[model samples]
Target: MEEKFLKVTQEGHFFDKHKSVLIAVSGGKDSMNLLHLLYKYQDILDIRIGVAHVNHQQRRESAEEEVYIKEWSERRSIPFHVSYFEGTFSEEAARTMRYDFFAEVMKQHDYTALVTAHHADDQAETIFMRLIRGSRLAHLSGMRVVQPFASGELIRPLLPFPKSELMNVPHFEDESNYSSLYFRNRIRNDYLPLLVNENPQFTSALLHVGKESELLHQALRDLICHIDVTNLQDFQAQTVAVRYFLLQHYLEEFPELQLTRDQFDQVLNILEKRANYQHHLKGDYYLIKDYQRFAITKIQPKTDRQEEEYVIESEGVFQHGSFIFSLNEPLEQPDQIIYLQVHQPILLRGRKAGDRILLHSIHKKIRRYFIDQKIPQKLRDTAIVIEQEGKIYGIANMVASDLSKSAKNDIIKATLYIKMKE
Candidate 1:
């Protein structure tokens, strides 16, 4: 068992020579065994070791467990760090808090790797549970032997070894493991034992499933390695399976976001819808789909608001929202080039209630005009118009009023330039 632990760490390249590592120990048999093994071979491995523990305060033995681990570390002259949870937390929240504290410790001490004692049984339990709950193909592979965490690596050297092999060392056991209150506890205590009894090789089979799923993920990753997900045209060109996998891969890049199968389908639905849309996800992040493009952005869509007016006194160049106005420049579209005869200090501004434009000696409300043109709500909010003496000249770059197009001398040729948001 000792030789296998060393071999796993060495073959996996879990540590560099003389690297510092922080081991996450819960004083449970599995973690204590891991700590003992690493301590025995620290000289041969050429590494420094530190111990980190978190007291969830869920069990009555929590305080005793914390002290036990601290004393064990002190006896070996190894550094020990600890944290305490203030109140109750769900299983997921507890797990998050535990890792967060581990990351904090690593940052302060410059530890290169965070070691955990998640053995083969734990891996099997995780994969089986995810399979039962229905998860993405990439997520079915269970915990990785080594993965990036915080600013360093999170290493699980005991992943390929079973729990039975790790119980040789004497250590504390949390009584909560036998309780059925937690979903994982129920799975481990009730369902898993029956499955193992029915087929003694069930755990091994689950382990094999994880390995196969990982291979499939690797193959899918290779297929789309060159594809750009943000490019709508490029993304839509792929088959559905390829697209789904790409999105899952994209979501994985963000540590703050947790990807569920439902969220996956929500994103797909928005992408498939014909019209441009902005679907709000958690916080201020949104999945934005514009004509010819789509992106993951934090910038909120331009909503209707009372916008400030900018007077175009003698515009060489003027910026308003996402638009740039270049005054006195020859425009590509003849109608959009407003040939102003009566210059009464033209102003550029967003839409207002009861705003109207003159068209062939008839008044047309700007709101009704936008509706007739089939402008999207976001575009309408940022849409600008040229106004002078309370008379609308034109909707920038879209249409020019007949009055603005009238033949005249001393005309100022003004055009609008749309600037793409960064």
Candidate 2:
């Protein structure tokens, strides 16, 4: 059994051979078997092993499962961490809390990577789920062996092994897994059997397809990275062209991956308009256009913000009003006279009723001059104004001046970045 598991790990390139691994254990058959296999090969593989369990508090027996795992780890002298989440245990909520706890544990222990017991059957079920939900090529690619998690990496070592093999291993079954109401169990029991009856090699074929799709997906990602347009002016326009070119290229090579005529046109329109657009493709893949770039994100139901932001100092990268202010050195240019200086106690506040700037070039009141320039009245209050010593020196999104004539050659520079509010 150990030799067979070792072969499976080799096939999947599970742990990079020598990295420390944390296995998410639920005292379920798959997780228990995974822990056993890892422990069996720990010395040979030069791997440090740890177990993490999340007591979701969903089922009454969940507490028993946690106790079993805790005792099991203690008897074996393996490090173990457990987290309990109270209240609701919706699948999404449970997953989110579980990963959050796992990440914290991983960070505390400085673990290099996390291993999961997601096997070939899991991959097949994922693919089917995405396909039924209208996923794209990227979505159909299924679970990746190595993927980025919070602070570390998630490695699926058992992907190349079948669930049949996992069942054959000495393990305990979770009664919860028998419910067909859960999408995954439904696919496993009802759908997978039909596919297997039709073609005994269906699971293997899906796994093979998943591997190939993963390679293709990686190549596409590499191409996008290689064509980095970070500094290109009108980057959004360029991104639109890049996306269109990619779609065309894929269509010519693999027509099966092509979006429908209307869908393709919609993508083109989204690129051309440079707007946020969500495209539901044939498979469970979604093309999301956010500002300048396009991404193929998974099609999960909309989730609330999982991360929260706290108030920060006004000097550094801080969120103010509805904008992210990243204070940096102002661009020095001979023609541009509106730049703030360092150590200058400039107040960042909203507009005042009697705000006025000395237009050095014109020698006139800035308010009157702006009125003459036909500046809109609606923008008066919301505009940011920088004031010092009860006088407006810099108008937000407008202009600034050198207060002291003696400091003409001082070359003081400060920048204000106004971000759009969502």
Candidate 3:
């Protein structure tokens, strides 16, 4: 078992022998074995070790596991950090929250890498799951041995070891793992056993296939990078041309690298359509077209949705979705009867065709006058115009009339303030 651990860690280049490591302990057999093995080898490796556990409030037994881990850490005099979350076990969400906690802990401490007990069986199960889900080669490649985590990095030193090898170390069993309701357990206890019975070397074959596929996948991705997708003036229109170029190049250089007809069609659809154009590729892979530079992004996903529109009204202070429109009562002036008064309610709606506006100064059709003024069609609707009983009193961004019916001693002026949403 020790020899196997050394071989895996050395081959995977998971961590430096003397680096400070934090092991994620779930009190399960896998994580327990991981902690024990690291401890057993710590002296020779000259490394510092810590244990981190997440108490997901799923079952009552989960609390017991946390207690066991905490006691074990104390016994070894190893620093321990436990995080608790109140939620059902949604695999994705739980994983995210757990990693976030792990990152925070790492930031507070000085850990070089966060190690976990994801072994060969876990990788095999993942590969099969992704395969059944019709995943691309990248997903089928399964979890990487070394990858970046929250603040530090994540290292899976046991990936090359089979579950049977870890049985030598003391461990605890979670009853939930036996339930076929969990997809991974079903693959481990049921499907994999049947495959092994049929062909004793099936697991080895799968591992081999995973490795070969990873290499081929990397090569294909490299070829994809060689094609210059930048400067495609119209992404939608040029999608077919870009795809055809890729197909031609692939056929000439790597005929074995053909995607399924459906997959090819889907790729083209993703490239051409605006809706899902921003969708990410597998495992730090992305397709990006930023003006003149088209590239693949390796970072985690970030969302930027379009901002929705808000409406504004007069007389009353209006709070739109993200914008605040405050309309103040006109300043009082004895002679200025044309100024906006607080008495009337203002209507706010989008513009429609043939909507006429009476310019107080000229009494002309506002739309034609706006067109003559060279106002763009897009901005015309947004340009606010105030009216009283179908008579245009003032046009915002254009003109404000001195609507005092009598020679004024004091005049009233309506003030409108637009504030953006927070």
lDDT per residue (tens digit) for residues 1-422 in model 2 = 56887876776666764367889998877788789889889877778999999887777888888888888889989899999997766777888888889899989998878888888889998988887877666667898778877677898887767777774554556777889878888888898899899999988887777778778867766776544232122334455546665555434333345576588777566656645577767777666655534444344442232123232224554454444445552333322233445566556566432244556543344556568877785554345565554445565455665453323445764554544444
- Cα lDDT, model 3, residue 385: 52
Q: Candidate 3's residue-wise lDDT over 173-247, tens digit each?
A: 788888888778888899989999999988888888788877866776576663433323333344565565553
Question: Can you give the TM-score per candidate against the true fold?
Answer: 0.70, 0.58, 0.57
Task: List all candidate RMSDs to the true structure.
Answer: 12.5, 14.1, 17.0
Q: Count the backbone clashes (under 3 Å) in each candidate.
A: 0, 6, 10
Most TM-score-accurate candidate? 1
| TM-score between candidate 1 and the true structure | 0.70
Q: Against the correct fold, how does model 3 do in TM-score?
A: 0.57
Regions of candidate 2 where Cα sits further than 4 Å from its true position: 8-13, 17-19, 167-170, 222-225, 229-267, 273-422
* Stretches of model 3 off by over 4 angstroms after superposition: 221-422
Among the numbered candidates, top lDDT falls to 1
Q: Model 2 — which ten-residue stretch has the worst lDDT?
A: 303-312
